[model samples]
Target: MDDIHAPTVASGLSSGIAPRDVSKVSMPDLMQEKERIEAELSALSSVLNSHGVNMNSSLTTFDGFPRDDIDIAQVRTTRVRIIHLRNDHKAVMTHLEKGLHDHFARLQNAPGATSANGTTVPSSAPTSVTDNSIADTGTLGTPFARVNSVEPGSPAHQAGLKMGDSIRGFGSVHWLNHERLSKVAEAVQQNEGRPLTVKVTRKNESGSGTTELDLQLTPRRNWGGRGLLGCHIVPL
Candidate 1:
């Protein structure tokens, strides 16, 4: 059987083997594996981003595209790596979830386990653990578009848009599967002369944490700008 089809330790024991308990897996080890998979995925995403492509974009062919500017062979290779990395990420996540479940189950079954409030903690007590480190993996309901440039006195400029700022969401354009940035264009055209909310993530000059900005931009033509947005946005 292929490696992909092979049974994993987390998938229970194979034929003629004793079933290994998930509780044997340490939480720290599971967390580390999760972080490693996330890092690999982030690295693959960066490679694709350098080529102006998102993880969701199909790279079937480079015809009529910037083959001269980008390394087509490198892109192809990275695409395959991304597929494998995504699969590995999924598997790791499954293992981590199971480990966490098993750990919490043991905790609840402990002899004298009680809540801080002196109440008996139920086994079904929320096992949900939030990891803030993964919060910036992507924006929710926001499209991540990089501002190429903003025309002076244009709607984008007037709205305080600057180059390098990532548009987390603008009007109806959210980060959910906005690989092509077509939603930003559609939002602009559909909301002309109307106030549109734009959320952006701007890197601080100190190179510390990012700053989130909520700007209201009114899209209009004849603002001495070429496009309705008055700013070039490229998918990141």
Candidate 2:
């Protein structure tokens, strides 16, 4: 994990330049930049986790701690890199929020737009909308992790988890600052062999919408697997 380094933007932007000035850029480009930054952040998080370090943990906790098998210098360097990447990621999100605001503002001022109850309503807005009412039922909460892989005959597999399933909720793990999926790991360790509720979103075959599903998984040792989960859960 020491060899793992912070990933650069997929757009090939050089360092030392402000990367969130996308005011004039099209929506597609803004989205692409957001995706790239998100991927980089996820990669950095995985690197930190591989070293038995939680991304949200304070760096000072490592000071004067045992490091016979770990490179303290590398840990410090990676922590600094993660900080910079987080700032950049936040900037990109801010840019996207501003872009959306500007877009809606334009639509509100567009010709024939109506103001209803002090709220601007676009005239071309759909008269009726279909409600995919799975939020409250299917999903226990907002999705925070994604299942990357599940081992065959493992707890995850027996629980009906598949690759690409977005984990909406697992035990007490919610969407609150779940960039490292550390809460899920903690829950697994504390509730071994106990059934834990898992909520996930699976894409429909037609790719038009998503369907949420609830599953029960029990974590235990000596499962003849590598990890307690027997599956890779990455922050989404």
Candidate 1 structure quality by residue, lDDT tens digits, 79-162: 666665566556655666555556667878899999889998887753432322222324242345789998899999999999
Number of clashing residue pairs, candidate 2: 0
> lDDT of candidate 2?
0.66
Error (Å) of candidate 1 at residue 173 is 1.7
The lDDT, on a scale of 0 to 1, for candidate 1 is: 0.65
Candidate 2 is scored at a TM of 0.45
The number of residue pairs in model 1 that clash at the backbone is 4
RMSD of every candidate to native, in Å, equals 12.0, 10.1
Give the Å shift of residue 92 in candidate 2.
17
Which residues of candidate 1, in runs, are more than 4 Å off? 1-143
